[model samples]
Target: MRTLETIIIGAGPCGIRTAIILKEAGVDVVVIEGAAPGGKINIAPRVDNYPGYKMISGPDLAAEFFSWLNDAGVEMIGDLVTSLTKEDDLFIVQCEHNTYKAKSVLIASGTKEKKLALPKEDKFFTRGISYCALCDGHFHKGQDVLVIGGGNTALKEAIFMADIAAHIYLIHRRNEFRGSNKYVKELNDLPNTTILTPYIPVELIGGDRLTGVKIQNVETKEERVLDVQGVFPLVGQIPNSTYVKIPGVLDQWGTIPVENKTKKTQVPGLFAGGDILPRDIRQIYLAEVDGKMAAKAILAYLEK
Candidate 1:
């Protein structure tokens, strides 16, 4: 197996940032990513909060990050890490194609979206079902669409879809929204948007491509089906920590608990950062900060 001083289990903003820092510090490090390097950021339509860019598309920002990685001489590998284990004094990383040994490992693996898991949900995915409003909303322009959830993501996406889709039906399981009042008010003000409360998705209705969704009232047994060309589910997120074989490092929510300053986990040689951490704010710049912190901590760990 190949050997290295450190291995980063992702190639998203955090992992790439960490690798850049380590490589510039003359440390041996490589980043392994299962999918595209940008992680979930690739699906975002526009990012207005990140520093240095007043307004930029998610893909453009990701490209800039990739360029920075190349300038820093950091190496990235396109491979999925299946498992991570510790043996003797080295960490063993098992991937789909190869295995490697490292003195330390950083888990920057991000989170995945929570699904509705209703019947035929899998069959209609990408056909008429989607998780990102910005990614698939354009395809259904001038058409009717459905947005599910009461969180900020769902609200913001519903507002965005208002300009594109002819009509939008926003459904939430609770009568009140979990998002900020600003977002809720903005979504409510949209003339093309309709808010339905205290309802849960029951089933998907369509053949081949989805034509509608069936939802049930949470308190009552009342059910209704909305006719739309697309359905966007923006409920919540789940951490990608299944590959971590180490115990006691993961919390009840499957997120990693790290030191506030160092981003160090319970294990000495294993660290975690980015969206994998249990932070309320999941932003690009914050993830980059986690990477910088973890890199500094890993360097100290390697020196000892």
Candidate 2:
């Protein structure tokens, strides 16, 4: 029943940054992470938007962040958090193997990729369908693949697979893309890329493994199937805030609504930031800023 000043529930950009700041301030704080330290950034193939480096890989950036945590003497606990509850102004964090009590808590768990929810999607999980192009693109060399979504992730993955896969079929529910114009232009110029707009995936067609995807045009209600060996669905992200047991703190999407200035949630001593907060843009720097702000806010709250 050891209680600390603060506990962060993630090790991503936001969590890492928040932990560093709190540690430097001499606050008793610990970060809990279930997966790798870098979080979703580890899955990214390339990151060209971060402030410091003009171009760098996601893993590289994450490694640098880990180094900072080490140098700052921030303690990180590796465990999967199951739930969060508050009792008598103290927060209780429940994990599979252990439990922790903290005076304050920060939820920076980030987001997970949204699934198409079509039947057979689970059956072909690793057989052919994948969410990470950098991890599975090599397996589809000289083969055809389907990329579903209309965001930057979909565009980037499509471009990355173009070199390995013989052909890339990118399908989106809308005719217009939600990604940057630069990515759209680059993806269009690729000789092996074909853009299918206004199409929604209706079913995943395969036997033992995925072989193709059945899509329908949103406008015409016409249906067609694309023959491919891989399916990358980068449709969107869903907040990883199920551990938050507090009612009225979560929105319809499960994302926590926080005060823009301080990242404070509806409950006192409970803060949220980074990808868990509803925002149009999701980036490492923005998440870092959220962490810094939340840490500072926590410090101020602790002072009182």
Candidate 3:
């Protein structure tokens, strides 16, 4: 088994940033990512939000990050972390082919994009359907689109769509929205927003790409189809925290329960960063800020 001073369990922006900081501080750190260094960045269309880079493609941004990683002399092991075992106050990281020992672990896996249940969704993804409004919304400007789910993310997406799209059809299975009332009122006030409550998507119709969405009313069982070239799924997100099983600080959803101001998790040496923990805002900038703060806490833990 290889031994290291610290093991970063993700290759996303957060993980890479943390590794850069630790290495610059003269700390021995190795980044272990399940996939490539830029986990979700590989699929992101274009990220215009991340500061310093005015406009950049996902792969381009990822490439730039890898360049910095190289300069920092950070060791990257592109392997999936299956599980973590605590042995004598150290963490044993179990991957597919290798096992690593580290004094501390930081989970920056972030939130995986939520999927649409439609079996055809997999086949049509990136062709017309998208889960990220900030990434794909501009492509459908002045065009009709369908927004599914009723949570805060969904409502916020609908609000975003209303800004550029000519029209939007908001569909939800519940008559009452699952998102906060304040945002729901804002969505309702939009002129182009059409609320289709108590309805759920049944199928996506299109020839080569998504042309429309088929929805049915749960109460009346009535069927209706909305014509559109784009479909956005803005439902809630699921955290990637199943690898570690530390006790006394987890909610039912496996998210680390931490104090609002401090990013301390249940375990002493273990900490979480990015959108993995539950919070009102999960923006890219916020996640990056949280990752930096979490790294500070981790550094503090190592000192004591």
The TM-score ranking, best first, is 2, 1, 3
**Model 1: runs farther than 4 Å from truth?**
219-221
Predicted candidate 2 versus true structure: per-residue lDDT over 39-101, tens digit per residue: 888888778768879888878988988899999999989999999999998999998889999
State which candidate has the highest TM-score.
2
Residue 131 lDDT in candidate 3: 86
Backbone collisions counted per model: 0, 0, 0
Candidate maximizing lDDT: 2
Return the TM-score for candidate 3, rounded to 2 decimals: 0.71
Candidate 1: worst-modelled 10 consecutive residues by lDDT: 40-49
- For residue 155, give model 3's deviation from the true position in Å: 9.9
Output the lDDT of residue 248, model 2.
86
TM-score against truth, every candidate: 0.92, 0.98, 0.71
Superposed by TM-score, candidate 2 places the C-alpha of residue 69 at a distance from the truth, in angstroms, of 1.0
Task: Give candidates' CA RMSD values in order.
Answer: 1.9, 1.0, 5.2
